[model samples]
Target: MESNLKWLRSCDLLIQNAYVFESALCRFVQKDVAVKDGLIVDVDKALALDSQKTLDGSGKYLIPGLVDIHMHIESSMTWPGAFYKQALRWGTTTLVADPHEIANVAGLEGIHEMISNALSLDIFFGIPSSVPSTREDLETTGGILDEGEVSELLKDPHMRCLGEVMNFNDLKQEDSKTRRLIQLCKQMRPDFLIEGHCPKLTGQDLSIYLAAGVDADHTHQTPASILEKAAKGMFLEIQDKSVTLENVQTLVTHALYDHFCFVTDDCMADKLYAKGHLNEVVKKAMAYGMPQTQAIYCATYTPARRMHLDDRGMIAPGKKADLVLLRDIASWQIEAVFKDGKPIASYPIPEASFSLSLYHSIHLDPLTEEIFQLHGYQGKAVQANVMVIEPHSTFTHRVIESIPIINGQIAYEKVGLNLVMVFERYGKNGQHAFGFVRNALQSSAALATSWAHDHHNLMVMGNDAKKMCKIANQVIACQGGYGIVDDHGQAMVHLPVGGIISDGPLAVTASELEEVTRRMRQAGYVHDHPIMSFATLSLPVSPELKITDAGLIDCRRQQIIPCIERVLTDEDND
Candidate 1:
């Protein structure tokens, strides 16, 4: 093969005789790659160049480093430094993180903290579009990112795109604040991407949302939705939950590889440590009959292109030398990872520093057992609106049932219901509300967590009022984290960082999370991911029914509905 002598001499590293993924063509071919000054200078067959370093890549697969287009660093319950360390081990060399979790807690200051701490990693920040994830009337949040905040955040160079527009209901309004925010992103950064979070939206609602300039969606997807959205020029980000055989088959059958990508929207610490990162998503797609080359393209090139990060998604000249070496393509075993032509082993893991305020975010008065009691019922039997947790999903179904009342307190246990409470822990109004969840805990136990989604309020659930109070107080005493109590004993995982993230190593956080999951299962809290599912219970923007410090929310209508539908008289009860 012909070679440039001067360029070859300047080459810093080379991998000879490997199956290189040519992302532009979405296929693998036998070739050699030459890196110089942290960028690929040449990729051809049998480049006879003697340079500084060379590795024999015979029988190995070389692909561009994986790029995760959408994720939350805080979702891992650890800081950016810890999350990146674990992600790097699995060949994820780049990340596009939505710091909305922390932004909802501390606004722009929180986002800035995450950006400063993540300088060592190739992480791009998205300006959190929905800091509260809903209107202030619907729920209470520690921080609010208004128009001024969004405009100010857009000035920062690190702010790449507007984070997931979670407030889909508000987007329907012609003059809503969310619409203005979308306009502002277009005005300020015309080229920046606008992400979406419209779960289960269809027909005119989906059309109206897309018309507002929002282009991508990472919500739970189905085969029909995939075809519909892709046909409408919308980019689909398939997360773990959306990686089913039917969905993968839809993409493969329709040959819609370029219109979609793989992302890890909200992975827990235990899952990241135990399973894997974006690699797991890639593996699942391949297992579901997606072509191996296409799966790799979706994880790398499509994602990078979706985010307009064209510099490092392919093994081509003039691109950043971010690459991954796979020893076994079938199993997705990564042998080594390179960033800027240097092996990851040469770089040290970065550490983060948090302020005192972040460590003490949870602020609320003490709680008593009476707080868990439902009051103001004047009838012996009352018809109450209950939030029913659908099996194996975050979406809850609303059900109305009649239950007996004793001394003005509803007998939730009589109707096979468990008490769920949300406390305003930001010390704003000391507001608290009570609701009931059906098909939750089977045994007599309580679980309290300050990691309640979006709002980050304190939420406790149990059939036993005293145990609920005990667990809630424990979580408050520690200022953050999860508290579980059952007949056996009690356990807690202290997440002191903003009351949502642990200020410890990733392994320690993962181990603690595993223990918490084990204990939750023992208490009969059945879910695929207990902690995350429980935390999202309070996210009002999700769907159907949810609870906040204000009251129970009918998410479809975007209004607070009374937990008790109506009081049943003696005749009605009979």
Candidate 2:
């Protein structure tokens, strides 16, 4: 390392008298910070000599660039180059991401591409701990990352943490693959972070999860439960849906600011551009009565410490100069962004390119309108189990509804019912399952996506079978992406490689995703986001009833249940 005293003060960038976030001070203080060769060399009156460049921080809050300890770049529907550059302007400097979306589709090859792209920027990865998430009976994924893949990835310096272990239900079971993956991680890097995806787990279940070496959770939980998890020594990675005013109040009153961090675990591209990335989390926490410094701390240092990344979370000497300058701290408006001691500028990032296998991910047989038809037995009416959509939540409610059969088929003309189906798009078994959905996609609308959470299977639902088929075919045509059909006509955003994300510019992708949202709203859907609607439908880790390519799964029991119930024959009734 070069000696700080040997360098002239006029060497590089100088930021003076800004409200710098001081970890040791536990608050902001007016201090001059100097950077050389992309690392902070000195602070507290370091810029007394002439400087080559200077940015006065008058009326500005100089902060260490926000670090998102947990997120999925694919959730933004953009590649690392685009997501990193787009989020930087919003004050996010470093990202710890999970590449399981691609891992599900392409296994080690996918993980390698994600790592290579992220290595070009301040992006680090948690090795995808659960590829294919669950067993093959519940869902089908194109790829599987076993012990061999995990061992290979652990050698890469960028692989800092083990990805979210979505197999929460299997931890207590002796022969679970999740346990093997966790044990492998422990054997490799005993200090590596193991992230979690357990939502609504409490008491003994929570204890079991923690005992399995889970160090963090990014799932939905109540304020009380959040406190309990943190108290039990598991770091909380709070997302937007769980960040109500009530929860924030509980956290602020206790001031366990160091125990938790703000993370946008799954932010879409359009929402990322409109609201902001993790900066939005900082703003919301402030609104919930968190002090500015504390909120900033949660967004910055807390997460970095969780990942054990000591190189770039602060502005002290020897830390990488990842800085975000804010015009106003209250609104969290970013004035400028600098990474590696250089300013970031707004420009369209080119689309990412990949190998032929990534491009040829779709392995589905051609689907038609007839494939969406719901067949009925020899009964006038039968009771059916339906997957109920609870707005703004990844969890679904399982409800029983009586269905009146007409002409030996389930009625498509029902007032509040929509046809939901999942196709094993990965070419694993070439299987498909049909189910019923209630209280979503109302009528005259359909949406299909290969970006279905965990499995990356083909998930589509709608009132119109023809339209649903059209959307599914569109996804097949592109190999992966989102397709929507409403009264306003049809629109598509082709994500070709794995259907989870695109190589396209984020600006272009965000605009197209925004258009899809607008069309979804116009068609009378009331979900907070349509992409969330598409992604969560197949994620079995979500609570209650969720659909998989195999069928509707009762997530709590971790077993497949019938979407439609059979009616007793007259002979049996007698």
Best by lDDT: 1
Backbone clashes in model 2, listed as residue pairs: 351-503
Worst 10 residues of 1 by lDDT: 1-10
lDDT, candidate 1, at 339:
86
Candidate 2 per-residue lDDT over residues 436-546, each given as its tens digit: 877677659898988888898898989888899998998898888888987778887779767778887777888888888787777767787666875787888778888
Q: Quote model 1's TM-score.
A: 0.97
Judge candidate 2 against the unseen true structure and give its global Cα lDDT, from 0 to 1. Answer: 0.83
Best-performing candidate as measured by TM-score: 1
TM-score of each: 0.97, 0.96
Candidate 1 ranges beyond 4 A from true positions: 1-7
Total clashing pairs in model 1: 0
| Native-to-model Cα distance after best TM-score fit, residue 453 in candidate 2, in Å | 1.0
* Deviation (Å) of 559 in candidate 2: 0.6
What are the per-residue Cα lDDT tens digits for candidate 1 across 499-552? Answer: 888868888888888888898888777787778777878999887899999999
